[model samples]
Target: MKLKLRIWRQSSADAKGRMVSYELDDVSEDASFLEMLDVLNERLIAEGDDPVAFDHDCREGICGACSLVIDGQPHGPQAATTTCQLHMRKFKDGDSIDIEPWRAGAFPVIKDLVVDRSAFDRIIQAGGYISAPTGTAPDAHAVPIPKQDADAAFSAAACIGCGACVAACPNGSGMLFMGAKVAHLGLTPQGQPERATRVLGMVAAHDEAGFGGCTNTGECAAACPKEIGLDVIGRLNADFRKAAIRAA
Candidate 1:
């Protein structure tokens, strides 16, 4: 198949960016999106042109490092799919594809299709972990957790921190991301002790990192590659309210 790509090119964070078009011919329909880019980069190198830059760690879609806004949709037009998991077959021959990095004040452009997502790491560091004692390995059956709580925690833990939620939100909100982090731990026994403080700190860090506030538009949940639900956000709000009232 042949394809036309209109990709955003920025030399650096301080530099201006524009869409640069390139025509790709004989691209295999079954090739992964990143693989198609690899082919494009090889061609560019042969032509003595700078190759397009994008992030991809573990290209298996587990790492969430392959971030791309394809054709005005985060991770392409598919629901519950990351860019790395997207296949070229999703597009038709002679289709023009628009590719850009995640757009948000918190996620600054590094170069080409790569963006600095360390803001997410900062939010995680703020208190997204539990304070469990580290000693000898405890048996998995040592602590008996209720089935419902375990399921909820597992569901929330499915989030991969891909930033699709923020990219899809009109306000650039990170609520679904933050909510998943909060709920994943809050529903578990090991995470109970730090639940209140963790929610408070992560939310504060999210705001400090310049992530916009959640407006309940629900776009975040819709764009989530993992299909993490907005119910996590609802749970997070309740937890935050409880924390605030307790602090007062």
Candidate 2:
């Protein structure tokens, strides 16, 4: 398949960015999005041109590092799929694809198609962890977590912190990401000890990172590659309320 890519190119964070067009011929339909880019970069290098820069690791969709806004959608037109998992078959021959980085204040562009996502790491570090003692592994069934809570926690834990939620939101909210982190621990017995503090700390960190507040627009969940539900946001709100009241 052939494609025309209109990709954003910026020399640095302070550099002005604009779309630069390139044509690719003989691209395999089976090529994953990042693989196609590899082909393109190889061609650019052979031609003595500066290759486009993008992020990718564990292209099986586990890493969430291959962030791309394709054709105006956060990971292309697919639902519940990350850019690394997106295939070239999604586009037709001669298609013009527009690619950009995640656009949010919290995710400032470092260069072409690469943004600094350390804000997410900061938010997680703020409190997205259990306060359990450091020791040898405990027995799986030692604390008997209810099946429902276990399932909910697993669902929330599916989030990969891709920042697509913020890119897709009109307000650029990190609520969905924050909510998933909170719910992942809040529903588990090992997390209960720090539940109150975790929610408060993570939410505050999210705000401090320049992410906007949640308005219940549901765009975050819709654009989420993991299909993590807005219900996690509700859980986050409830947990935050409880934490605030206790602190009062």
Candidate 3:
């Protein structure tokens, strides 16, 4: 396959960026998107040109590190897939692809296709952890969780901390991500100790990270690679309301 890539090239966080076009030929349909970028970087190096920079790790899609907006889609046109899992065959033989980074104030572009996502790390540190003592795991039967709640919590826990949810949001809200973090733990008995504080701290950190508020447009859930539902956001709101009232 042959592809024309219009990539956003930025040298540093404060540097100017623009879409630069390049052409690739002999691209294998089986190549993952990051693999295709590797080919392009190889060619650029051989030509004495600076290679494009992009984020990627664990290309099997578990890491959620490979982030790219292909042709206006957060992770290409595919639904429920990350950029690392996207294949070249998804495109036509002579397709024009727009490769860019996650566009959000909270996720500023560092260079080419890499963005500084440390803000997400900060959000997690605010309240995404349980206060369990470091020790051996409790017996499986110690505190049996209902299957329904366990399933819901597991689904919310599927979130990979990818910023696609924010990137796809018109308001650049981290609501989906924050909500997932809240729900996964809030649904369980173990999460009860810090339930009220968790919502407050996470929401505060989310806003401090420059993430905008959600307007219930549902774009975040739609763009989520894990398919985390907007229902998680509803849970987050309810928890926040109850927490705020109790604090009062």
Candidate 4:
């Protein structure tokens, strides 16, 4: 298949960016989106031109590194799909595709399609873990977490922190990502001890990192590759309110 790509090009964080167009022929329908880019880079490199840069790892979609907005959709037009898992077949011949990095102030582009997502790491460090030590792996039935709570916790934990939530949000809020981390722990009995502090610290870090506040537009959950629900954000807000009151 033949295709046209309009990609954002920026050499550095401070460099100006613009869409540059290129055309390619003989693309395989089975080729994953990243593989298509690889083909384009190969041709550019063979001509001594700087290859387009994009983030990718574990192309099977486990790693959220393949962050991109394809044709105005995060991870292409497919619902609940990551860019690495998107296929050329999803497009038609002669289609013009616009590829851009995750657009959010908290996730500034480092170059080409890569953005600095260390803001997520900072939020995690703030309080995404249970500091209480479990010296060794416990018996499978030791804690006996309610199946309902366990399922909810597992669902929340599915979040891959891809920043698609932020990219899709009109306000650039990361509440979906932040809420997932909070709910993942909060739903589990082991996470109770730090529940209050976890919500407080993470929310503080989230704001400090320049992420916007959630306003219930629901775009974050819709764009989530993991299908993390806006319900997690509700849980986050509930926890935050309780935490704030407790602190007072």
Per-model clash counts, in order, read 0, 0, 0, 0
Model 2 pairs whose backbones collide: none
Per-residue C-alpha lDDT of model 4 across residues 33-90, encoded as one tens digit per residue: 9999999999999999899999998998887889999998888899999999999999
Q: What's each prediction's TM-score?
A: 0.98, 0.98, 0.98, 0.99
Off by over 4 Å in 2: none
In candidate 4 the C-alpha lDDT for residue 96 amounts to 97
State how far residue 150 of model 2 sits from its true place (Å): 0.6
Global lDDT scores for all candidate models = 0.93, 0.93, 0.93, 0.94
Model 2, C-alpha of 93: deviation from truth (Å): 0.8
Superposed model 4: Cα runs more than 4 Å off: none
Q: Model 3 over residues 23-45: C-alpha lDDT tens digits? A: 99999999998899999999999
**Per-residue alpha-carbon lDDT of model 1 for 1-248, expressed as tens digits?**
99999999999999999999999999998999999999999999999999999999998878989899999899999888889889988989999999999999899999999999999999899989988678997999998999999999999999999999999899888999999999999998899898899999999999999999998998888888999999999999999999989988
Model 3 worst lDDT run, 10 consecutive residues: 58-67
Give candidate 3's whole-model lDDT: 0.93
Model 4 — which ten-residue stretch has the worst lDDT?
Answer: 131-140
Model 3 alpha-carbon miss at residue 248, Å: 1.7
lDDT of 1: 0.93
